[model samples]
Target: MKNVLTYACMILMLTSSFMVNAQLPSKEKQYLLDFNKSTHGEQWQNKWNLQEDPSTWYGVEIKDGHVTALKLYRNNLKGSIPDGISILSELKTLNLAFNTIDGELPEDIFLLATLTSLKLEMNKLKGSLPQDYSKMTNLEELSMFNNLLQGEIPNGIGDISNLKTLNLSSNYLEGSLPKSIEKLHKLERLELFGNKLAGAIEVDLGRLVNLKELILSYNQFQGDLPSSMATLSNLEFVQLQGNDFRSLNSLLRLQSSKLAVFDSDDEFLNMKFGANEANRTRLVDTKYEDTKRN
Candidate 1:
């Protein structure tokens, strides 16, 4: 009887040890630990306390025992994002915008297939965008505006069929707009102003039937405006300043029936589209003025 009791106690101790070990090694926990240490998370506006349940952490949302979202916008998070972030297989949204986070964006973060919204805008992040953006098929909104990112826009970015709003403005990105961009059937707003991008705008832009605001001002774009743009029935604002555009007659004709906004610097209008009443009338109402020009 004494031997049996001792053996039973030993079995219980071994089972408890197994349980503890299994619970101690969580990928999500490790991700947080690495992220916190790597980014100086202790200094964040809403610092995370690793001692407590991750669900209770600030800006972190856990669903079904998995981290689903991490929104630390403008949180003063410094240092590069850790590659361990990709371990959050259930993560849907990751917004680290308006922070001091600087360094090349980790390519693995783009591999998060569950991500629907990834906003890292207004950070000091440098380095070229990844060439292979095809892994993020579930992405809906991708905004990386006002960063120090350089290099040509990746061709694979257009593979994100569900993408709606793509804003990469105010970067050092160069190269022509990829032809694959026409594949984004769901895209609405595309802002690429203040870059070094050169090359004629793709004629396939007319394929973006759902496009509402097309902001492509302040680039090195040259060549005649695509006539297909006249087909964009939903286009409300077309900001095309600071570029060497050859003509905008087709775009002006678009303004005749629909309420549209066009840049009205008389000299610029005359130089690009020629002096026409349609251009003047489109400018007179100025209510639809492209506010993003400034």
Candidate 2:
């Protein structure tokens, strides 16, 4: 009789384990649930509500109960993001640009550890930003330009050491850029144009070893650029027009190798230094007349 009771107990335990495993949703499905609170997201809540007819959703891709991607570009979405959208443990991409969504972005979004791309631009978002922004360490692309965002840019953002492309232009953000940015050693493209930012653009910006496009035009920056050792030896071009650049005479001819354009303006454009040379004179012309391009 003791043997019989032991066997029954083992069977019960095995059955319980199986049930728990079956109930756990796959990593992808959790992602679908994470960003489903946005305007069009509501239509994707129930799989049965969607599986029967897939076209109703602006865009959604799921496999094995996991959401792999979501694209709602130019959808005219409205309303606040629901906290539940943070459950997308396997979600990789999210694009909800060109809409009228208002209010602060949900802080819980930082819980998405696997997210790589995020585009929330051209909206009405406003807030200080969530502390968990560092949790998105795997992020490769981030764009939130043309929004009503405000307050300090999160300093811990440098914790995302693998970031490649970043665009935070056209916002109400103010304050000095975090010194931590020098740690994004793998960044390729960075754009922070059109904001109310002040203070010296961090001189360490030249440390991004792989950076190609560095556009920081249209702001209140003051002071000459630091002559620190540069990390962007491979830089394709740099745009520094429409600011309070103090010393252009020193920077215009620093590298005979010639940056696509180490641009500066007429007030400080030293014609005498390179006035006799054709290429050198062209830099002055480009610096002034070509300011619109960079």
Candidate 3:
């Protein structure tokens, strides 16, 4: 009787595992397999056993028979992303940062309407951002810093109304700040440092009342620092060095008591302030340095 019971338990477990594997649609499974092959999965730091069930795949999140998230940060993933990635229709988050992934970003990646957070920072992705990015309405965080991307930031970026963090620093992106960017009312952190962007910041940044960290150093931006920025009471860290701005005098009226690190080209602007104001904010007016990335 003991032997029979043990055999029955093993059979039940096998059946349950089979059922779980069967839940994933065959098309989606093929998409995963293609992704593995295209990215040299066998060489990854944490690779998946293709012979096993899709649920057991590394960095893949399966929910209700659909791939929901794929996070493989710093996992030694090489080669470019497969175009079939858009087939994972229910994917909500896709993070493949700090890897050796190269080539132009697959256009299908922007078609994932369900994606809420898309992080591909510190990769070798090259090419300009797509012109029509309005489909990613659910995106909350879009970070693609430290890449070789160039061309102007698309005007369609303003359509992602829910975006909170937008970091595209250390890239070769050029052109002036888009006028449509002022539509991000919920934005908190905006970092575009170490780019080739130029022209006066004409966008109405005062609309972003929730902004906290604003870094735009090491660019070709000139003209007066917009006075509207002073209304951002939530700002904590502000860096605007390495630019040819006429003056940063408007920032002296900043109302944020939480201001800690305020980096700028002090010598270039010949900026001077009273001791009372300097002591209150502990403002650091020094040259901004670019962060070393791997």
Clashes of each: 0, 6, 0
Cα RMSDs, all models:
9.1, 10.2, 5.2
The candidate, 1 or 3, that scores higher on TM-score is 3
Clashes, model 3: 0
Find the 10 residues in a row with the least total lDDT in model 2: 285-294
As a whole number from 0 to 100, the lDDT of residue 123 in candidate 1 is 88
Please write out the lDDT profile of model 1 over residues 1-294, one tens digit for every residue.
999999999999977755543453388888888988888988988898888867668888776567788888778899999886788888899988878899999879888999999988888999998877777889989988889999999888988989998989889999999988999989998888789999887848788988887878788988888888778888765677788878776665553234355562336544443444565443322322223211
Q: Each candidate's lDDT (Cα)?
A: 0.79, 0.64, 0.84
* Deviation in Å, model 3, residue 95 alpha carbon: 0.8
- Model 2, position 57, has a per-residue lDDT of 41
Error of 3 at 218 (Å): 0.2
Q: How much lDDT does candidate 2 score?
A: 0.64
Ranking by TM-score: 3, 1, 2
Reference-based TM-score, model 2: 0.72
- Give candidate 1's error at residue 187 in angstroms: 0.3
Best by TM-score: 3
Distance (Å) between predicted and true CA of 292, model 1? 17
Model 1 regions lying over 4 Å from their true place: 1-25, 255-260, 264-294
